[model samples]
Target chain A: MATATKMRFGIVIFPGSNCETDTWHALNDQMGAPVDYIWHGETDLSGYDCVILPGGFSYGDYLRTGAVARFSPVMGAVMEFADKGGLVLGICNGFQIMLEAGMLPGAMMRNVCQTLVCKYVHLRVETTDGPYTRAMSKGQVLRIPIAHGEGNYYADEAALADLKRNDQIVFRFSTAEGEITPEANPNGSLENIAGICNRERNVLGLMPHPERCSDPILGSADGRLVWESLLQAV
Target chain B: MAKARVTITLKKTIMDAQGQTVEKALHNLGYEGVGNLRIGKYIEMELNGAPATELPAQVDEMCRRLLANPIIEDFHVEIEE
Candidate 1:
C-alpha cells in the first residue's frame, strides 16, 4: 500500500480563491506530502492523486457563488478526473463550485440569517465508509472552522432521499458531544449537512475549512484525519 | 440585432432572505401593503445579430447553463429585435 507521503495532492486555484496557500501549507508543510497548485485554466489533472477546490470568493463570487467559476476550463478536467474514480474534495467555495459544476448534487443558498458566518464549529462524522472519512469513526466530532455566506445546503426531496439511501452523507453539524441540533447548524442547511460524498464515494464536498484546522498550533488537529484517511484509501 | 432581458429569482419553495429583509424594511417605512414582495435579478444583453426565432431558445440555454441554478431558482427571458 502506498503511504500518505507518496500521494501527490493538487489544489486548484481559481481567480479569487484565497485558500490554496493554506491548503498547500496543510498538505505540504504540515503533512509532509507532495503538493502542487493547479491554475483554473489548466485542463490536465492527471498527475495528482487528490484534487481540492479550496475556499474563497472564486470569480469574486459574482453572478452567484461558484456559478461563474463552474464554467472555468479546469472544471471540465475535474469532472473527467472524478469520472475516472479519482479522489476530489471541495471545501467551502469549492463545495459551492462542485454543486454548480454538477459534480455533486444540491445547491447552496444565502444563509438563513443573511449574514456571513465565520466560526469554529463541531462536525459529527456521519459515516466513515468513504475515503475522506475512513480514518474517523461514525459519530466522532471534529472541531473545524467555516467562513461563508452561502453554505445553506439544499436539495429536492428526491435527491435527499437518494443521498440517504446511498449513505452519501459524510458529516453533519453537531454539538461537541455529537448531538445533531438546529443550534449546531450554523448555516441552516437541511438536516444540518456539513459534508457529503458522491455515490461512488470518490468525490466529497464540505463547507468547513479542514485545511485551516489541520495543525495543533492552529487550535485543532482534527482535520488532519481527513488527509490521513485519504492517504490510507489511496 | 437583438436585445435580451433575463429575470432570475429564487424558486418559491426556497426562502429568499434578502427579499424578505427588504420587504420588512419597506413595511417599517410605511409600505405595509407590500406583500409577497420577492427580489430577483435582471440582466440585459444585446446579441449582435441573431434571428428572433432563435433568441428564445438560445437565451433559455444561457439561463440553464449559467444564468440561473435550476435547483433553487427559476428564470424568464424576453427578447426584442
Candidate 2:
C-alpha cells in the first residue's frame, strides 16, 4: 500500500449495480483497504483518488447499458473528475455505460452469440500501464469472469486506427484457434478489443470482472493484480 | 414539411456480434434460410431547411454531434420530399 492518508475511493452504485458490494469487499476488505459507496444521484465527487463504475444493469439495461445512467447527476461529476485526470475504472455494465456516456470511444452492441454470457474468459493484458494495471505486466493473461449480453464493441475504422496508433488497446481476446483475429473476438468486439483506456490514460474500462477474481475461494485469483494495482498506485 | 430518414450502423470493419447471434438464434429456431443479418437503427426526422440547400450539412452536423460516435458508428441520411 502507498501509505497515503485519506485513501478515498468511491464506487458508483446504480439501481441494478449487483457488483458494488463485491467490488467494495475486494477493495476494502480483501485488499486490506476501505472505500466509500456513492449513489448515482450524488453530485459531489470531492477528495477521492479512485472512482469505479461497478457491474450490473443500470436502469434495467434500458436504452442500452449505462445509456440512461450516464445522465445521472453523479455522472456529471464523474466526467469532471475524469477530465481532471483522476483514475476511474468501469467493469462489465460499467464498461457498457462508459461507451454510451462517451467517456471513452466505441459503443457496445449485443453479443454475437445473442445469449447472455456467464463464464470465465481469458484476457490477455496488453502491456498494462494504467492505475488499475500497475501490478501486472504486459501480455499477461488473466482468467476473469464475464457476464453480459451486450459486450460486443464496435467503432469506425478511423477510431480503431486511433486506438491502435495510441496504444490504447488494453485487453484482447486470444483466439481459440491459435490466432488473434477479430473472428476470435468473443462477444463480437471489433479488433478483438476487450479493454481500453481513455485519452489521458487515467480512465480504464474492461469487460472482465477483476473484482470477482480477487479471492481464490470463489474460483480463481487472477483478479488480485487489478486490485493490487490500485493499492500500488496510491 | 421536408423530412429525412437516418440510418445508423456500425462500420463494416467493426463486427456486429448481435446480428450474428440473432442469425444463429434464427437457425436454432429452425429458420435456417437466412444469411448476413446486419442490424442498424433507423430514425426519421423533420427538417426546416429551405430550398433543400443546407439540409445536407445540417443533418450531417446532427448525426455527427449526437446521433453517432465518430470513432465506430456511421450514419446515412436521406431527404424526403
Candidate 3:
C-alpha cells in the first residue's frame, strides 16, 4: 500500500504530441502522482513504474498514422519495459503507435465516415483483471472522449479469436445503458473495441482520451478510476 | 543507382471507406464505369549505389517492416536500375 506513493509515471513526447501536458496534468496535478516527460529519442526507462504514449499527430501522421513514430528510439526502451511486465498505457495516437510497433495486436484504419470523430463516448468495461482496470468492475460504463481520424480498429479473425480467448479486450464502445450496437460504434471498430491489453495484461492501448476527462470540472471524472487502478495495482 | 516503387492497399477483407466515398462521387459525376474503385498509396524512393540484385529483397523488407501493415494492408514493389 505504501508503495503506491512511489509509483512514478513517464509520458513519451514525440514531435507533434499535443496531449503530454494533459496527461501530465491528470497524473501529477489532479492525482498528486510524480510524472515526467520523456522525449521520443530517449532509450532508458529504468526510473519509472509506468510509461505512457500520449496522443498526437506524430510525424504529421505521414504514410500511416503511426508508421514513422514506431521507429523512435524510445519505443525500443518502451518495448523492453513492457516485455519485463512494466505497465504501459497508450491513448489514441499512442494506441496507433503501439499497433505499428507490434506492441499491440491489430491495426487502425480510417473512420467509416472518412472523417475525424471527436466526441464524448460511452465505453463499457469488459474486464477488470488487468492493471489498468483493476479498480473498476466489469460492465461498468464510463464516459470518455475520443478524438481521431483513424481509429477504426481491425484484427484478423484468428487474432480476434485469440484476444477473446485470452480476455485481452478491456473496453468496448456501448450505449449509455451499455448495449453494444453498431450505432454505439463511432469508428467501425471490430466488436466496438475501444481498448485492449496485451497478453501479459501490463500494456494497454485505447483510443479514448481518458486524461481529457479526469476532472469533474471537465465534465467527468470517470477517467480518474483508470489512474486509481494503476496506483492500486502498483 | 536503383529506384523502387511500392503500392500499398487495404486488404480485400477490409472495407475501404475512402474508396467507397470516392466511388460515390464518381457516380454522381456520371462516371458509372468507375466501379470497384479502391484507394491506395504509392511510394517511390531512390537507393544510391545499391546492387540491383539486392534491391528487390531490400525494398520488400522495407514494405513489410514499415510501409505496409500486414494486418490491414498488402504491398507490391517494383524496382528499376
lDDT of 1 at A212: 95
Clashing pairs in 3: none
Top of the candidates by lDDT:
3
Residue lDDT tens for model 3, A124-225: 999999889999999999999999999999998998999999999999999999999999999999999999999999999999999999989999999998
lDDT of 2 by residue, A51-104 (tens): 999999898986357767887899899999999988889999898888878888
Q: Where is model 3 more than 4 Å wrong at Cα?
A: A1-4
Native contacts present in each candidate (fraction): 0.94, 0.71, 1.00
lDDT of 3: 0.93
1 or 2, greater by DockQ:
1
Question: Who is ahead in DockQ, 2 or 3?
Answer: 3
Give DockQ per model, in order.
Answer: 0.92, 0.42, 0.95
Indicate the worst ten consecutive residues by lDDT in candidate 2 chain B.
B64-73
Superior candidate under TM-score, 2 versus 3? 3
Give per-residue CA lDDT, model 1, range A1-234, as digits (tens): 223478989999999999999998888887888999999999999889999999999999999899999989999999999999899999999999999999999999999888999999999999999899889998999999999999999999999999999999999999999999899999889999999889999999999998999889999989899988988886
- Evaluated against the true structure, the overall lDDT of model 1 is 0.93
Task: Quote each prediction's TM-score.
Answer: 0.97, 0.79, 0.98
Q: What is the TM-score of chain B alone in each candidate?
A: 0.92, 0.86, 0.93
Ordered by TM-score, highest first, the candidates read 3, 1, 2
Which should have the higher TM-score, number 1 or number 2? Answer: 1
True contacts kept of 2: 0.71
